[model samples]
Target: MSTMTVKRAELKPGEVLCSYCTARCCRYFALPIETPETWEDYDHMRWYVMHGSCAIFVDEDVWFLMVYGDCKYLLEDYRCGNYEDRPQICRTYTTDECEYDNDGTYDRLFETPEQIWEYAHAVLPPKKKKKKKKSATEVSHQKLPIVHI
Candidate 1:
């Protein structure tokens, strides 16, 4: 019997806390969003969220819209370019609402694209084309199943 091992990545909390790295999170991480539901609505959402590095989030009562881009003042060393005179939001940001404090887990929550799709799909109708049943002879003859759309 072969034993399989799955390796999990370890994060450095100290590196996140002590290092003055470029504000990568602010630069590239996405905002989450809450949406109105309709097939058309979801179709539009599918179009939008299907792109590179876009995400939607719903946490408790809050919603977020995420897009990938960097903060204007983020420097190469992970230091805030304007640390001394950072914007009010960044300056007042508390670790309490931070991913670092939370170990960046959407672990308790569904974080990936597929997870969100499953949630959305549950609320929507089945998207797969309904297939017509075939006789055993058809199977033996290698006939493709006919899909009824």
Candidate 2:
């Protein structure tokens, strides 16, 4: 995808964001997640990535499950439909420091379950299977008496 670059001195921050054709910030949302350490944790993360438009990313040791979907308020022209009554989070968001400039800052990213699973296998130790010994009853062919109700 081609990114729009503008001369910072010529336009204000709002104008810079407005001139950008694609609303990169509104295209996705990320929820912070616990770092996967165990097989089960990684398995759950794999399940999350298996869903459509879902991905796992790690930025600065913090993990997040990124869901790729356009914001409901975002219009076709890359503008917020409810700019006047936008949410507090949106109001506080500044274009000067946004994801658009540092889209590739993630330390690690997993777009698919296979990728996460592979990384899990690489980092986690292989599970050891214990051999079960034969029971005394099976070896001696002896059975316990059954109680009648």
Candidate 3:
């Protein structure tokens, strides 16, 4: 039997953090949203997508409103200025499960209002139109049975 040797890869200083120069994880945050069930709900979501740096996505059946904006703590070099005293949420975030690793995990992502509108047209029911009622004058104009005194 022949024996084989394996070597582990080594990372340079700040290599893991430096690799993600764009700081994608620090640039955006998503808030949970109720699944749109009506045209109004879908229309509101379309309005959200119409704004700059705003988007919507679904992951594992959960929908979210994603807002893109750089974190106040992120420095110009893509480093966190308050790394030592970062929030618990930030501290808990792991690089292995970051957006940089899996950018295609979103089931549906809408980057523009047109995209959301297209989806709405496919999934939402058509709006119903209310019929106009006949006026009293129009009703009086109809032929009526003659009454004799």
Q: Considering summed lDDT, which 10 consecutive residues are worst modelled in model 1? A: 1-10
Question: Which candidate should be chosen as best, given lDDT against the real structure?
Answer: 2
TM-score rank order: 2, 3, 1
Model 3, range 3-116, lDDT digits (tens) per residue? 222122344555563454467788989999999988889899998987789899999899999999999999887788899999999988886556654546688988988888
Error of 2 at 119 (Å): 0.3
Clashing pairs in 2: none
The candidate that achieves the highest TM-score relative to the unseen native structure:
2
Clashes of each: 14, 0, 0
Instruction: Tell me how candidate 1 scores on lDDT.
Output: 0.56
Residue-level lDDT of model 2, residues 1-149, one tens digit each, is 22557554566644654465477788999999998889999999999987879899988899999999999999877888999999898889886767554646579989988999899989999966778887987868866689999
- The 10-residue segment with the lowest total lDDT in model 2: 1-10
Candidate 1 C-alpha lDDT tens digits along 6-59: 122333444334142224456665555555465555555556667756656566
lDDT of 1 at 54: 61
Candidate 2 structure lDDT: 0.82
